[model samples]
Target: MKTLLRLSFAAIFAALVGCATPQVPVPLDQSFYTADKKTVGLMLEAPKAPGLALEGNIGLLDYAIIAAATSSLTDHIEGQDLGEFLAVAEELSQNLENEGFELVRLQVPEKAPKLAKFKDPDGKDTTYFAAKDHRTLADQYQVDYLLKLTATRAGLARPYYGFIPTDAPRAVFNVHGEMIDMSSNQLLWYSDIAHSAYATGEWDEGPSFPGLTNTYYVVMNKAKQDVLGALAKRESATGTLALNDDEEAEATESSETPAESQQ
Candidate 1:
């Protein structure tokens, strides 16, 4: 059991793209963060896709190999929500407030209410907002700026198993978020966010398999922390957000602190 756990740990860590893959402030418009913008509301919207399809051909042992390594192929696992989304929101809100930007918690509608996701005139997925209804929401909330976590794609499975270089277990995902001007309905910022936690060939956090929901839980938490760091402009550099400083305080302090639950 101990040896198996160690092997599994090695397998997971092997797949991690540690301390990289995210660029902060996400290269937003210069005007997004101005001198007088007071309040900002958060819209948490993202597609949760789990179990990227395995791509390749394999013989009999393939079945057992895949079975042992992956949790599910294409079952829409939604993976799991270890409360990372809410944590991200909470962190952002607090960060903005500390920076003198008022924070407003917007309610995620029960139904699809009025989504702001669509192709724009520029032939790009430039801005996706719910047109009139979203504007109404903005008006109702009285927020000056709206930040939307456009998409957070996370899961624990080898998406391009055959195409990738190595066979190791790592928590991986492609996540991005943006800021928007509700009045003009424009994209203010954007970035491709990624995070990872390489298992250390030991039961550091807990036992490990080839991959599991728990693996992503650990990974997403790290990702959520950086999302706040980037938006707060604290992690403006192109390296991992430094840990041994005051900038890391919130990421450390509030990680266990859950945001108000959402639907």
Candidate 2:
């Protein structure tokens, strides 16, 4: 009975993941990032307790059982004094400062729906939360833009195919982040990125689960680095605007110099 259920679930899960279309990210618009809209409300999701995610195929009953069974283990992992999650968040805050953004740190209900997926007019798959959905947050914070880093999931990921392990378990960290224009409800930027790392040695360490724990931190750091990298690309784009301005000024001066020489 269990074997049959597992197979059924695995086949469905595999098909779902396999058939899903990839989504293209919405790029940050240069005009929206201008000095006129320097104030941005920064919202970061609160971290949740770590646990295992079963992928491939698994029945709902079995999934629930496993989740309940691993609750204690997840709790222990969460209590290990591994470290605080502040470093990357602080790094993000500092980067926004360096970019001349007036950061207004704000809090929203952690569980509030902040994103939605849909096809744009061009029929390209894209993810964005409705602009009006965040209007209250924007109005409350009195900011014209909102930048959000949604909650993260940190734990082990095991992929299975019909009662067979497809690959070794890995530590994973994932989150969805976006920047939106509150006034127009335009999604200025959005990206869904994840990082995972495998254990270097024995992973089934009993009470402490050190190997998996270490890998968890590895992916966590990588995930944060991913955010920084994406933000840097956007900042670099803003720098291009500055470069264009300089070139224009030089062009104007050169044109005037030639006119004076002709005079």
Candidate 3:
């Protein structure tokens, strides 16, 4: 009976993951940056997925589980980055900044205690990390734009064939992420994907390893790249950026021919 149940779920899961379409970046709209604004706040949230589980996980004893339990046992563990996520907004600003907003840097004292809260109690876009006094945050740093980035929600699943693991079976990885424009309190872009063949590069067959498996890093990177690509600035004609007043004066003096003074 127990074996039947595991097989049943695995079959259903496999069917779902196998037929799913590959996901891509959302349609980007640079039009949202139409306002005269500068100074952007970075909000990179942590990823989370509460329900996904790994089957047959007992560390050194994984293969030793009783026949039934071996196929039924499951475990789950979360992944986190040291500080790699902090620079996303800043990196994205190389061209976007010139569009209008400059990302605000947070020093030790200036950093917020919680700058990555995901959602509210109701699973809605509460954005608790965005400081209650939005106006104050904006005024303090003169930040007119706040780019709130929800962490990529990563989930993992290992599908089985008839309660047995196949040769190098792929793992399913799904992520849903978005960018919010706090100035208008609306979504600027969004992308969500669930894939194994495409997300983990299991489709291509040129290079094959003896036992290469997908890890959190692989899945998370795919999701992260999607966001970066979606937000990437499109190449376009642009004028020379205006320099600050001091630099402008220095440039003016340097460009002048030393007053063509009598020598």
* Arranged by lDDT, best first: 2, 1, 3
List per-prediction Cα lDDT, in the order shown.
0.54, 0.61, 0.44
List the candidate numbers ranked by TM-score, top first.
Answer: 2, 1, 3
Backbone clashes under 3 angstroms, per model: 6, 1, 2
Candidate 2 versus the native: TM-score?
Answer: 0.66
With a 3 Å backbone cut-off (N, CA, C), the pairs that clash in candidate 1 are 11-168, 11-169, 12-169, 116-128, 116-129, 116-130
lDDT of 1 by residue, 47-130 (tens): 434433232333334544554544332232343454665567776776676667887777766686565544355635444432
lDDT of 3 by residue, 1-263 (tens): 33334434665676689775443344544555555655666555544332233344223233233334433222222233313344455666764666666776433334554444333334354222221334334445455555556543333344344345543333344445544455443445556644443223452232321121234444444455445656655444562333447646855765683321110
TM-score, model 3 to reference: 0.44
Question: Ten consecutive residues with minimal summed lDDT in candidate 1?
Answer: 202-211
Best by lDDT: 2
Q: How well does candidate 1 match the true structure in TM-score terms? A: 0.55
